[model samples]
Target: MTLSNDTLSELPADVARPGYDRAALTPGIVHIGCGNFHRAHQAVYLDDLFNLGEGHDWALMGAGVRPGDAKMRDAVLAQDGLYSVIELDPAAKSARVIGSMVGFAEVASGNAPLIAAMSQPSVRIVSLTVTEGGYYIDPKTGTFSPTHPDIQADAANPDHPETAFGAIIAALKARRASGVPPFTVMCCDNVPHNGHVTRDAVCGLAELSDPELSAWIKTNVAFPNSMVDRITPATGPRERALAQSFGIEDAAPVTCEPFRQWVMEDNFPAGRPALEKVGVTFTDAVDRFETMKIRILNGGHAIIAYAAGLRDIEYAHEAMADDQIRAYLDKIETTEILPIVPPVPDTDLNDYKQLILSRFSNPEVADTIRRLCHDGSNRQPKFIITSISDCLAQGRDCTGLILESALWCRYCYGTSETGAEIAPNDPNWDRLVAQSKLAKERPAAWLEMSEIYGDLAENAEVVAKFTALLNDVWARGSHSVIADYLTG
Candidate 1:
């Protein structure tokens, strides 16, 4: 049976469906970027809350600004906004159909429909999962880049904006003009201070056209910082097959590890669901939790990704199974990354590190190495470079951290150790490839990209170590260099 509102009762006996009345559901949240991660994480949380027969008015209305989002909107609306979440663990697997999303806004040329949907008085909250790179942050200064072409275009034509932040600003303008209260802007991305980052983007874009409106947003809007975690891989044939195995054909079935977490600041002035009743942690010190997770888990992914990518490993679990790759990850986190991370409340950092390792080792998720390694230009600055900066500030060892940077540079050369081509993975692939070629002769050339390395390039000690490690990798191969680092 095809998965839809009509076929919900026809699903397998074990597969869980919504217990509440879908017809009575109301939209309280307008979420942008309805990708795999949002479907698996936030949507699942709302699904659980609705199952408890509460927050029926807090249903999700998905919206997006990208052209690809039109495809996702079609796939989701075809099944009446119904899809399956398949949690995979080595011990067991289970499927649940999520119905928290009541509708998807039409994807149009000027985002008129999205702006109209968000301007509704009922949409008390606007959430986003637009990925780390989508925020238009300047890598060197860690501030919103108002000069970006997309931001410029939106500022020039605020009435018919093209970007998500632009549409948000347009909606807020409508709400303010028509005597409606402003909605809370919640960011669910993995970046540190994600809420603050979102506020910067939204208000920064607003400042371009209307400084008064920008001040109003800064004063009235509440952007709650959040940390979201779930090992949901990109949906493909395998995941669709898994859904079919459950006797429900779902076009966009999300397959993920059984573990999930969301640590958020309780700053929704417009109100929010009682998500704490459903395992979401609302805390004052969300930054501490954010730091622990980003450095250890996301940073750990970067730690293992380049080496595995160089060696032509397919899945993240397969890379973890490699003794050398696993050992490198363990050593880097213990010595370089964990030492600088601040104390999270009621949590042991060591135990958290172990949990991250276990999650990476879960064979059932089948998370891709390519996915982990993609977009190094954006991710390296957030995940790996921050830890290196902290270690440098405290006068600690940065040998492993610099080596990780070298591994990324080597990977950008576009070839695996096995002589296979590594297709372009980053948005700035051409520039990275050009720099990688130059760094082959002079390793400092890679660090010279001030946009990425910033003042870190001025440190003689870091420069020398990076040069040596990168040279060793190009000369003797990644395996040999890794072995030397392990023994040295």
Candidate 2:
């Protein structure tokens, strides 16, 4: 039977449904992105809270701004905002219907309904998982791009906003006008210092239009930095079939690895869910945790994905099981990535790196190379390039990282080592192709993407080293390049 309140009782015994009273659940959070990651991570936490009967007042009210979100809204609302979260493992699997989401707003056109929904006093937290690129941040300056068309449009017409941050500003404006307290803006995206970046985006946009409103947000609103980790692949027919095996006919389901973690600073101003009651770790400082995960796990993903892509390895575990690929990842992490990460409280960095290796080698997870390698423009800046910056600052041996960058540049050339076609994977695919083509000739041409490389591209010493590797990667091939780097 389809997963819904009316059909909850009819679900198979293997599939779990909420035991708490769904009707008692109230809207306390208006999440701006309703994608699979949010379902598998934050919504799962809230679902656990509701099951405990403690966070009934903190139910999630889903919202989105992308055009594709309108379709997700229809699917979610069709099932009364109820969906199944199926955890994947090599041996066993489990499924549950999460009931923490109570409603969704119509976001097909402008975010009028979303603004109206967030304006309500019940919505005390406006959380988001709007991807790493959604924040409109300049990767070079690490500042909000006020000149972005959406920000420009929103600054011009704040009431009829077009972006999620703009909608948030409009809602805050309404709340201020109505004499309601502003909601805490929680950022659950995987960006580094996500809360600060979110603040820069919303507050920066606000300043362009209303200096007073920007001051109010700066003074009153809360943006909590968080470290969210889970390997939730995009739901597909295979997941639908898996759900059916559990006798769940959920139209919208999220599938992820059994492992999950959420570490965040305790900075919610307008009340929040009792997520700590679940597995979430609340801390006074989240910087160390975020840095550890972003560097070792996130950056390591880039290392394996790009290198694996060059080898045409299809899945994460398969690539990880490859001796050379695993060594490449460990070499980069231990020598380069780990040294740059500051000490996380009560956590051993080496052990954490091992744990990440085991997680990546989970065979049953079936995470694809394409999924990991997608969005290099965003992932490289936050995950890969940041570490390069630290290496440059600390004068560390960055040979592995330099080779990884060369692999990335080669991967962007749209072909694999064995003459396999690599389809466009980056948001700036055209630019990447043009630069890669030029770099194939000049070897220094790839650094011309200043928007991504920033001033790092102009450093003659660094460029010389990178160009040497780029030339070797092209002349000798990726495998020989890796093998020689390993031995040399």
- Alpha carbon deviation, residue 194, candidate 1 (Å): 0.9
Superposed on all Cα atoms, model 2 deviates from the true structure by an RMSD in Å of: 1.1
Q: Which residue pairs collide in model 1, if any?
A: none
- Provide the lDDT at 267 for model 2: 89
Taking all chains together, each candidate's TM-score versus the true structure is 0.99, 0.98
Report model 1's TM-score to 2 decimal places.
0.99
What is the per-residue lDDT of model 2 for residues 68-109, given as tens digits with 9 covering 90 to 100? 998999999999889999888778899999998999998856
In candidate 2, position 480 carries an lDDT of 84
Task: Give Cα-based local distance difference scores for all models.
Answer: 0.94, 0.90
Error of 2 at 41 (Å): 0.5
User: How much does candidate 2 score in TM-score?
Assistant: 0.98
Best by TM-score: 1
Q: Pick the candidate with the highest lDDT.
A: 1
Model 1 misplaced stretches (Cα beyond 4 Å): none
User: Model 1 over residues 1-488: C-alpha lDDT tens digits?
Assistant: 88788888888899999999999999999999999999999999999999999999999999999999999999999999999999998998999999999999999979999999999999999999898899999987999999999999999999999999999999999999999999999999988899999999999999999999999999999999999999899999999999999888998899999999999999989999999989999999899999999899999999999999999999999999999999999999998888999999999999999999999999999999999999999999889888888999999998888999999999999999888999999999999999999999999999998889888889898899999999999999988888887886
